[model samples]
Target chain A: MADGTTTAELDAPGDLVSVADRLDGWLEELDEPETLVEGRREAWERYRELPMPQTASEEWRYTDVEDLRPEDFGFVEPEAARSVEIEDLPATVQEVLAGEQDRSGVAVQVDAGEVYRRLDPELEEQGVVFAPIVEVARERPELLEDRLFSSEVTDAEEKFWTLHRAIFSGGYLLYVPENVRVPEPVHAFRYLEREDAIVGSHTLVVAERGAEVTCVEEFLSPDLEETSLSVGGVEVFAGENATVRYISLQRYGRGVEHYSVQHATTGKDSHLSGFNVALGSDRHRADVTSHVEGPGSESEMLALWFGDGDQHIDHHTLQYHKAPHAYSDLLYKGALTDRGRSVFRGVIRVAQEAQLTDAYQTNRNLLLSEDSHANALPNLEIEADDVRCSHGATVGQVDESQLFYLKSRGLTPLQAERLLVFGFFEEVLGRVPVEGVRSRVRSAIERKLGF
Target chain B: MADKLLEVRDLHVTVEDEDIEILKGVDLEVDHGEIHALMGPNGSGKSTLAKLISGHPSFIASRGEVLYEGDDVLEMEPDERARAGVFMAFQYPSEIPGVSISNFLRTAINAGRDEEDEISVFDFRKRLKDALELLDMDESFADRYVNDGFSGGEKKRNEILQMAVLQPTLALLDETDSGLDIDALKVVADGVNRIGDQNQDLGVLLITHYQRILNYIEPDRVHVMIDGKIVESGGPELAEQLEEQGYDWLREEKEPVSA
Candidate 1:
């Protein structure tokens, strides 16, 4: 195991290492197991060696990542482990947070790297591990060693994941032992405090054989005033016959910039579903990929985003079928108002050896204003002739007739437009099984719509 | 004259992009407590007239004045017109996906009511329940998205439910009877009739391509519009005569005037 170099070793004139070095110093004190330390060291070296992705790269043709230099932002260290005051948040955020607490069985609040509170002690007694990433590393080194910073099954050669692996400061780590079923969802909340402050966090989840767990990660900022940066990575491992539902709601302030990468793998007969709701951020990018590594595994991916003002949100999803008889489905939808812009690129790939694979991808966008824009690209690649793969994309504005119908019933045009946009988003939001999480997402969407 | 609900004087409207004048110098007046049925053929501009009165942005009113409760409605926005007690039940209502019917209705009701006096959630729920009961709508419908995945009959009934809740002074039923089965038509007409009976001062401008809805909700006056103009006017018997003889006789009578 090795610890990464200090700021002095990496910083140079006109180089971004000075900011990166500051971030490194903040993470240097985080406790990690020997294996994880070694993995992170290797990841840091790899990040230094890898080149930033450019628009010329086929994988990043539609995305412009050159503007995301590290020098543009400063590193944010956890100043004080202050409890998040819900009353200080926007009414929409407060309502959503309160609603989730009322409905969910387990709620864990992570303020920066600190775990402020954890609900449902009984479930914690049932061999369910829910704690800060640092504690998890110290308590369950074996599980962390096996999965932490592991990129063998996923496509992690990208610059963003490399940087995330090298610099992630604090995150949540959840583990469900064999044969245990968690009825209530495990919640993780991460709050970003300063604008233009870089935040790199990682979440690792493992569910042993026949175990079931649901985890929700919420990202929020104080308001849309700061020009911040958040790069997050999450990895999920579902053991044989296990089931895991993961939801990530990124409701950053409008001034923040965000990039996220989530990779998940499922074992034989395991089921995994992931949802993402993007309501805030001036510019946001999310790249999520799921791999069915064992037969009979199933993966479902759903996303909904509402972009307003000058916000820009981009989402990319991939479902890779590596084992035979695996099923995967992806649906992403967004509504753009004002001059906001959004892009969605989704792909479903079935490997040659993955016979009898079933894969589907669909992306839909609703443009709420003439000035707003949306772009969708859906692709499918099938190497196995017996496998079924399909993809589709659609971009459209709200139907004027529908708006008229609502307006005729005394709804103002804005109210009618909001209703139509909400309806357009329902296709993806409806699939979320957790009522509280779904309501929270709904409230966030309404708030973004200025309801 | 003081009790007149809607008065259209020389309302000239043109269908966008086409030289066709759908509502050509049409004159009509509907008084409070009266149900006026506007019957015409496919190209008779019945729908256009209804749209013009409701302030649809697409319709260009070249020369006309639409007075709703004695105010010029031609300059008003669609929502403004609605708030001013003008309502039009669409022929094909748009389906809104994520918004629940309950939320949509409440927002509409609140927007139409006094802005300072917000209705309580309990009171709103009570009102919604009463209206839904009147329309025979299932309780589940309130939770479902507005008009999303609704059957044709269900959508029409929902329109009437909205009308009942809004309680507009001037209700324009634009082809409300179209695309509905006989059973659905009766249910929808019954709902409209109930609203009319309950709000006796409500004035209705019922626009229809067929006379079937007239059987259940009898109209006090009937007017035949052809080629964007009111060609003939009479009592309810005119609707029956046109339904029986078709617009062929009217077309022949108007063809000479065209030359």
Candidate 2:
């Protein structure tokens, strides 16, 4: 992706420059495999060569990063994390865990440190691996050497993507073997408590043929007085006949800026479903994509965001159907109140070889206040003549009729509005297969709605 | 002493943003435990009166008074009026996607009660179960979103279900029998009758364009409204007369009655 885009136009931000200079120190602290060490070095070099994304670029038309003062955030120093019990985790994390007890495993990352991780013995005994990515690299480097830095992981050429690659800590890895179906979902909680700290985390899931698994990851932090930053990446691989469901809940507190790039590729007859809930963060940009690589593969992408305060949430999604007879559907819904703003752009690309592909994309936004705003842009680029592809986008205010109906049933105006917003997101929430994830997402939305 | 369960005294209502009046000084009264059928032709201001009583913002009560148990009902917000035991069964109920009927009913029940008196989940489930059974609706109906994608019959039955569960002292049935098949109309009517029978003090104002529904759920008195005013009031015989002759006679009579 180094297509001669010169970085000479501008100097790197001081905050990110400081982080880049500490890469050697980060590498020294984590005794990792040679392959990963080389990967980090390459990523850091690319980070230096790439330029910060500008709003002038089409991909960032709605989000402006020039106002970001990342220097206000201090880099989290790497230290040996003291292992703690599940009970010792933060109260918020405990509350999340309390809602779901039928998990195959749970991992907690605090301030870019793995504090607690557990995998059911039965699954572990069956060669299923759920652990920190660094540990997995050190123990079984072969498992990641070919897949970690592969093109399937991230096609993004953005500087944040490279920055995340170079500095990510306490990364998560979930690998299921062939023909093994994990009955319960494995959960991960990434919590940041230190004020004004820059942190990065990476999550990778690989399912072999006929394997089935569900993973739920949440990013959480307490509201901070100063600005903080997070650059994260997520990659998923569903093998032949495999099924994988990933639910990501982003609940970073106010004064936090987050950038994450997520990509998934499906195998023959496999299904990959992803649900993203963005409720917090002062400024967040999420780029998600589903690549249907094999015939008969199915990809379902869903996201719901509730923004309030001065939050600015931007989401861009792509459904790329590269193989014939593949099916992909995307649904994104959001609600904004106060001075909150949201931007959603989605594209469905059907390649020439993807004949008979069935693809649909929809984005709906409910602006709850006059000051709140939402922009939705849905596009389609289809090269296959026989494929069926359609896209739709809508931006609307709360329906007075709906509100009146609820109010007439005895609910107050506030309660009625909240219920309407919740119901607006119900289309996506109802499809979330994981009960625990669904409940947690609902609670996060309630929290945003001040319930 | 409380004057009546509901008393509309020379009520004048107007459509918002329009100079034309929808209800011109109409007066009516319903006593406790009485079922009064309000019969009118389309666009004769029958629904307007019901909406004004329920505090629908689309219609303005430009003048006059709506008293509930001798208290000013128009002064209350829609929700407050609901908590005060005034309910309206709409002709075309608004469909609330994604909210289950059971959930909406529970929230409505809770909204009517004090915090300390919130209904328990078990009790709510039982109440919903009973209401559904009384409406002859499948148990799964409670799990579906409120009136979403429901057939006309189902929507009317749902309104009756809500009426049964809420047990309001006063119910304004706005053309509840308009879009129902015979069997569905019977089920919905039976639901209303059962609830009315259970609550002896329940006062119902059944608004309908046709008198077919009165066959199943009888009304103590029937009032014919023409041109936004009650032209006549009598017993069940009034409904039978309107059914045989239609509303043209009443529209022509235009004789104001002491309702």
Candidate 3:
């Protein structure tokens, strides 16, 4: 904090492993409760003991993270609470604020830049909590203690998750009390536009019995330079007969290396939707899962991405059915252009007790450039004889007849191509349940396409 | 620059990848304000000539001259040729999902106009609405995707609607009468006749296997094509002859020349 630019602990640069080794003490100092300090200490020790996942690991086969040196990134403050007024925001944000969208609340986190939160008064009166997780931890410790780091992804997870749990700088928590259904969606805008920085952002949502809420979280950046590392995790807890819709849109700058883990655990007869749209990031890997721990639960997982330039996007998903009469459907679609590449690996696992389970998974890719490539692996593991599971994957170029038809109508080649690509992506984007989030996502994709 | 509205001379065309010639030395001409029908048997290369004139990538015209309004139509891209007022109604129009009819039409309408002279929303909407009514299309059809789930007759009628909107100087209708019932054929024929009345100087080259469409929209001249060449040229009475007595007699008559 000498010059107020770089923090004291991260001021000195070290090699990758050494920097990975030294982040624990900073996290320990940053925690509020002594319990979190202990949690950070133990998680850090475990993170050090575990080796980083490599290309040799089957889960990381197509991904290469060797060039990501830990010493090149460090945590910085999100500047300050500068100009939180709606008009002073980005044009997209301003446009969103202009209309009276169905919104319960909105929060904007700009890098270590600034944080602005606006909670609907009526919703807040109804005991809907949308605030920093730290505040929630202080006010309602019991609610978070049992749920924090309780992801079914397991304690022995990959290195990024281990690091995230160890030193996650900031995150949000949304809590909907029993039977208090929220009518509008909660918007969270997370902007990471820092130079050579590491950001660990997390979000946790808990919907009690019969409660319903939708959360839309988007990652953004106006100006990006050098390299930035983003480690994000989102976990949802749905109680009996509750419903939760979670949308995560990552359209960060191309100078980013983003890794995310999103998972949800649903109780009896609950429904959960985890939608993801990854359009930016030079290299990105996202692993999303739904663990149906209760009977008669259903989960819908959908994802859409358009990779331009030489960006490499990789996605892995899981539909883990541990209870009977569970249902899950997953679809992932992408369009690649100009040497861009994408890989999709998904699995639907039904346990023996999960009889009468139904699951389906499909992945489709359209190649807009000859050199672009798509790799898909959709797998199913069923231990129950009474379960039905199916998976399909396809990779092909745009239909030639479709192109010729548009061109014959006087559209230029590039315009005709972009229209087809957008049509291909609509299958996934159109499924988003939040209207504000959907339009903002559309605009983001439009901007990325340079239209 | 030239009195001839559309001219084709010594056209020798083949599929791009193969040596098999589809059109061998085709010669035809259509004066302004005239309608010419190219009646041919199946696989006789009538559609191939239309595709070649519009610069379709699949076909290569090895030797030919196609002059449209004094411009070399063969030297242009399909889109450029279309912008230059040479229209080709596809035999099988492609389907595009998620692109609404309104947006597609608006884009096409704007593509050929200068930046400052781009069609205004009010004018474009008026034109589209008028065309939609003329085609008997439901107003809500404006929001539907282009040809994605259209019936055969609907797709052909839509093609005619596009031709009316574009107001091309020359139109090449390839099998527009195929796969259509009498009612649909009359509707499509009426749409073409409407275009003819609106653009009196327009020239049309209508290619069809059957002369059924001719009963509604009369052709000024008729040319019988076989084995990629125009074997015979005659008046409207020839279509009636072909309709009553199929193409076998003509095939036998042109055996020596075709071989």
Candidate 4:
């Protein structure tokens, strides 16, 4: 409770510190887990002590985070009537949701900081806790005490994480007991819909030893004309020999700003794989960090993005090997057209204790138009004597010979170029193990290409 | 000679971006049902001649008139030339990923077919099967990406498969046997031979630097090209002669000494 209180106080807005006080008062009304309260408070204090990240920070170099001022956006609760109306779902998202038939697991919908839907009775009976962050704090304090904000592996890298910790209002939390495997994917969707609306959603997933689960978090909007901001953080903990797959698809409409931090910690012999497909947003930035802390662990990160018409997609990735005999492989591919731009900065760091680590990082870009731009910076920092680490970045255009060959075979130039671009994206899109997600991503890419 | 399938007169061409002319002045004529083998050294403009006749945009035809069945081909686009019965098997084929061989071959065939005609999937499959069988290629090859991960012999064989499907009037085999081993070369040669026999009206222009392919599909006329001009014209015996004497002896002789 002390740590949670401190965190709330530290996160209190300067002019509107009373907002934090009011939030704390609201949190006290719920039945929260004691341990979670302490953990949240400690995270709050730590966040208050940390300074805002500037361009000097290696992770913040390419991304413009200075424009993200807390004073510019204030917390505003979503309208209850519109929040509960399912018919307001965007046409694209409605189409996807209507097509989905397998709804066996938990289904959650969060508008702003309010939870509109939750269906997880069987999970509750199996000792699996699936609830909103505030409820998780009130009900399972012990779980939050040690695991809530205690996973500090990615705290030092970005200023947004601290802000997320300080101001996060509500998010989804899931915990599966040891050896428990959820057959269906847990689905959560977040909606940011309003002018200057700011949302801080926190997602914490912990899979006990030998547990298996799949989680999908989707970010979207109801209207393209609204100016909105979203800062999200996701932390995944995989216990010994556990298997976890986390996928995040961000498709915010035009004029929306998004920033996200995703971190995964793997235990001995554990496996964690993540896929991110970013499509929409006027300005979007993401930091994905994977920490391999135990031997025999492996992590795979895959991402695909298509930027068109003044959109900017910036991604920073960190593959940290903290223990020996661990491995990580990351592959990111993107295509830019119609004056769009993208920047990818990836780092593979092998710590002193992480000997015999095998890590590889690669980023590839295809520039379809002359005005489209792509900048890639791949780096490596190795302190271990016995390790294999390599990084590469490539930027190229459609091969003229390939175009001629396809055209010679009766395909128009545009058709041929489309096929080649699809082939270039197949390397990353093929790795998405989920069929529905893959199809959705493909459809989004096609829409972006105006197909 | 009156049923000439291809007629080129005083053709002059140069490589793009350079004043160095490759095809200085060349004249040749090939009637229907004739396989003309053009043998030349590396820089004698054998490939440039093929491009000029096939309407390749990179080669500048300074002075030449290519008439295919009395239609001037210089005004046609590359694809138009292809549809108008000019087929050229590239010396080095480009690899196209994500486009399957069946799709590519079907598109090419449909493009060349009658405008009112449409190929159903069933008919396309049957045609593909028959073509693959004629080429002795595996059925799985049709489903693979076009020329992607294909071996040199497989690429050349795939080219011939295309030729068999499209059934072009004039087929230009440009160095198709360059990288193939003995077995692969035999397979490619046999495929070409089958296509030639099936389409008697097909005028074949076999461009190669080696005489091995001539052993399989005997050419009716062998034209020795030197400095972009046909210097010697004779039967297949000229190919055997050139194979033995090399181009050095022919390089020294300035005039067209009858073979």
Candidate 5:
């Protein structure tokens, strides 16, 4: 980014939106190769052409983004963070860093830049590349140049996609070569400490043939007072016969507005499964997709969300089957409390050549209060008659019979409801392959339920 | 007579939000060390009375009173009633997936304990072992999710196991033998019989639709119910008479003498 410090791009007074106009400085500052620098310029051009979504836009009809006027938010410096030592971190981060649980490695990121990362010496000897993208650019420039701006997501086609490309700063690059299996999970934490600053980062995970790996990334905010913004994206590449699991947990404070796009591409005979747990954020929009491009590929997409207060959480997913004998399943479950609201929209598409494909999508929501709301839309498009695809969704309140059953056993109404809610989430959380992340997600859910 | 374990005086209960009176002025009593069988035909409001005593919100107790050892229980919450030692083995136990039986039962036991008298882990384990042996249940049963994917008879057995662990003063069995084979029936009846023998002051109210379960666990008193009211109260022979002639004779007797 530009040396050390730069003034924030304050929007003009009385104007509702023009935040997208500040992308010129960010795009010019991106440290990139000559070939991709041209791509970045085009991305900026397309971003200018792409219109910010209005309230009635079909892409976000279920969610109203009218309040997100560009004039209300401004972009901060790429490395705008007040560095803190590990011991001076929040108790939550300290507890995680104490190494009570087994992890392959851990990295701490603030303001889209990694401050500290530690990996086992054995992994370095084994030639596993786990480091921040900037370090990767300096040490392994070709690897970053090849995969940096090249993802299944188009740069300027969608507003969020274009915005992510034009203003993105720093993120993680996890590479596991052929036949290498990381025995334990790798962890990364992303946070923001400055008020009225915006962070856009991208995470890329490329697993070579026959590789197996699991990585977890969490997002946090130091305070919940002033408005902050975070725009992030993830791309996972699972090579032939490779198995990859990537989990992203977003718990930004209430004053933060978050947007992310998580997508993965699986090749022949590969398996890709992960989780998206969106627990906090005043307004969150996460777009997650899985594309099965090779024969015998499998993809499992799972998500869990809890929206309390007036929080608005949105999750959109796409399962694209491109080759024969591919299987894809997506399940998104959420619980809404108080005046909270959530939206889940998932689509499964099987191309004509994708015969013998099997796909299923389901969304289940539990409304803890009458004031809360949940909208689920599951769509499917099959160009092949031989494919088997189905979608189902259900929205209801806490089961009265189940609640009474618990209360009758001597638990109060609150305890019974919480237990039942936990049970409701267990069905999908059980699918989380990594034990450590699963337990962390469990504790987070418990905290949400307690509140 | 020994101290009264439970007393019901002219109890009247109706379905909440509707004028449908399910338990119409029913009166009954069970003293210490007594086993009472409440027998009735299908749709005879037998389950309603069981739910009423357990303080189910769906049932409104319009009149009368329920006293447990001289304290009024009608005003208490369901959980309060449970903590006060009133246990009702539901006819259809719920399946709580993802929660193991051990955790659920421990919570129940912990809820019933006084803050200062919380059971130690050693004691809880010992009690669980003793109860398991008394019920002839396997060790794996404690780890399984509570009633989730359990067979009909297994659910009934789980109910008895809860009773064995809780050791309530007044135990209400609501059709606990309806869906059991003869072997499963013996296991459940044997467990209740052993509990009764051990706790001589414990009172048992076994509600059943048929006389099959009464055959396994002999009762000190039998009451015949029809149309939400008890039609006959006598010795164990009352259950035998209803099993043989069915509720037709009781219906004929319950009606006023025609003309």
Candidate 6:
């Protein structure tokens, strides 16, 4: 609308008008460095050029998004900088923050701008950069452009990926220098409060060689009156011998539709662990990948989701083993009730040079209602002969015998089911090393169970 | 209240999904503080009767009345029966992974009591410790998942431990001696006797194929079940007679009567 658009691009079609039409306006108000703007412009071009995902594609066979009308959701322009204290935040956001009292830093974002950001002075003095990406890009744009625009780190070529890159806002950048180990986790909270708004946020973590850090990202929103969209991205770079742990809890309201792409690449001898707990949103599709690119690297991916009230959730995971002597393990579990459904597609791909690559993947789903459904698809593509790779999947209902056994002990039906559900997820929950994060996840599960 | 702690009168049952009958007009009674041993070979519906009294969903009572303390037990659910102080030590207990025994037992105890009378953690721990010691179990056993990866002997011991903690008014031991060795059987029988002694009004229906368990836990009455019906009821000697005669003489005596 500002006269810089070419006639040919403007004439594209009605389908691209909603999100694409607002890109230029959002970019103008984004307030970033020139280099970052240029990168976003290129991403916008690619976003317009790529076609929308279709169910005919193998990647989306079980999840259909044709009914989504992007035009119905409007993008919010960047909000003016305002001083927002922790007490002024929503109760839901405050409750989550209170769960992790030992966090070294915390950032809270609402809609299109960050509301509050804080970091421990000691960590900042140690040359660690933990702040909003927009603020950091204003000072050193190169630091962000290099990672944001890197194809090797974010290989997702979907339309949503391009859209997120073009207009991601309110994300945090965590940078730990070599040999620095942060004792406490850094927390990032993203919340959506506006109705019929499309919110896109990003998270970037760079743990340099010999560094160790743990970061937890929590997403939550109040039950909105109208449906909205959330497109998110997370990129992690674990350098040689560095140890990084990233945990994300998605607890959006039922009126929200979410699409997230999470990618992590590990260097030699680096250890990376990612845990995702998704229990919100009316519809959500998450693509989580762990790229083991260096020898002696280890990656652990764990996720759990609970769906109720006709919610539809889908997850696709990739364990890409490109170096020898790398180990990757993934375990994803989900539960559904009240006609809710879930889809899981996992791939363990070992490259030819990746000998001695040990990869294991397991997906289990518990159906609590007869009408609830789940589909699990696990695949292995190993070009290396010496690699040890295995995958397993199971979709089962709550065992009546187990329920009876618990009930015979005098537990009420609801209590029995709750205990069994927690029991089913205990294996993964116990694996979470952080006490604060584990308890927060446990409380979230209790909330989902309507306790 | 009823004179008998448990009264099963002319009870008949069949598998819920199958047409075959399991319990054919079974009749039995156990007074307060009495131990009645129901003996029969495999497939004599010994377990079915216990399961039916416990309200297992698989077995539906076609015609009968199961009265516990003058209340119709057939009208209640399994959980309701459990809350009413009726307990059954399963022949093969279900394994519930990831649920610790301590947590499960605490939840069960709290569920069976009134909301305001819920047991505190300290009290529950003390009771669990006492029960474990009574069964000669180590403290670590309570930390393990409920019956998961437990040996057969351990499973039986856990059942007895649960019985000790719950302290039910009526207890049904369904083939509790089947999978136990001589030592395990002795430990389990000793546990039952100790619990019975502690709860003076406790009534037990001990179902077993062999009379070996009767040696430790004396029985006031022994009922012989052959082909879904109790053929004879006598004192503890009936158990030894069936154990020695191998249920054949009873079967032969019944063959002429049926013909």
Q: Estimate the Cα RMSD of every predicted model relative to the unseen true structure.
A: 5.1, 6.1, 4.2, 6.0, 4.0, 5.5
With a 3 Å backbone cut-off (N, CA, C), the pairs that clash in candidate 5 are: none
Q: Taking the tens digit of each residue's C-alpha lDDT, what string does model 6 give over A275-300?
A: 98888889989999898997999999
Considering chain A alone, report the TM-score of candidate 1 relative to the true chain A: 0.87
Q: How well does each candidate superpose onto the true structure, as a TM-score?
A: 0.88, 0.94, 0.91, 0.85, 0.92, 0.93
Model 6 chain A poorest 10 in a row by lDDT = A1-10
- So what's the TM-score on candidate 3? 0.91
What is candidate 1's lDDT per residue for B3-113, written digit by digit as tens?
Answer: 468889998998777787778899999999999999887877888888888877688889978888888888788888988888888877878877888888888878756
Over 4 Å off, model 3: A1-24, A27-31, A67-72, A77-102, A112-114, A154-157, A293-296, A447-450, B257-259
- Residues B120-191 of candidate 6 have per-residue lDDT tens digits of 889999999999999889999999999999998899999999998887999999889988899988989999
Best by DockQ: 2
Q: Could you give candidate 2's per-residue lDDT for residues A239-351 as a string of tens digits?
A: 99999999989988887888888989999999999998898889888999898998999999999998888989999998988999999999999999999999998889999
* B-chain TM-score for every candidate: 0.94, 0.96, 0.96, 0.94, 0.96, 0.97
Which regions of candidate 6 deviate over 4 angstroms? Answer: A1-19, A25-30, A67-72, A79-82, A140-146, A151-157, B112-114, B257-259
Judge candidate 2 at residue B153 and give its lDDT.
83
* lDDT digits (tens) for residues A46-107 of candidate 5: 76676666657545887876556532356654553233456645556777667446788777
Model 3 Cα lDDT, one tens digit per residue, A1-451: 0011222221223323333545655654563676766776776777677766777776777887755654346655323233355544566555666764668888876664334677778988898888666666677788787788778674324677876776665577899999999888888877775667787778999999999999988787654677778888888999999999999888777788889988899899999998988887888889898998889998999998888888999999989999999899998998888899999999899999999999999999988788999999888888999988999999999898888888888877877877787777777877888776677667766766678
DockQ of 6: 0.69
Q: Best to worst by lDDT, what's the order? A: 6, 2, 3, 5, 1, 4
Please tell me how candidate 6 rates in CAPRI terms.
Answer: medium
Q: Is candidate 1 or candidate 2 better by TM-score?
A: 2
Kindly report which residue pairs in candidate 3 clash with one another: A77-A112, A78-A112, A78-A113
Worst 10 residues of 5 chain A by lDDT: A9-18
**Quick one: RMSD of model 5?**
4.0
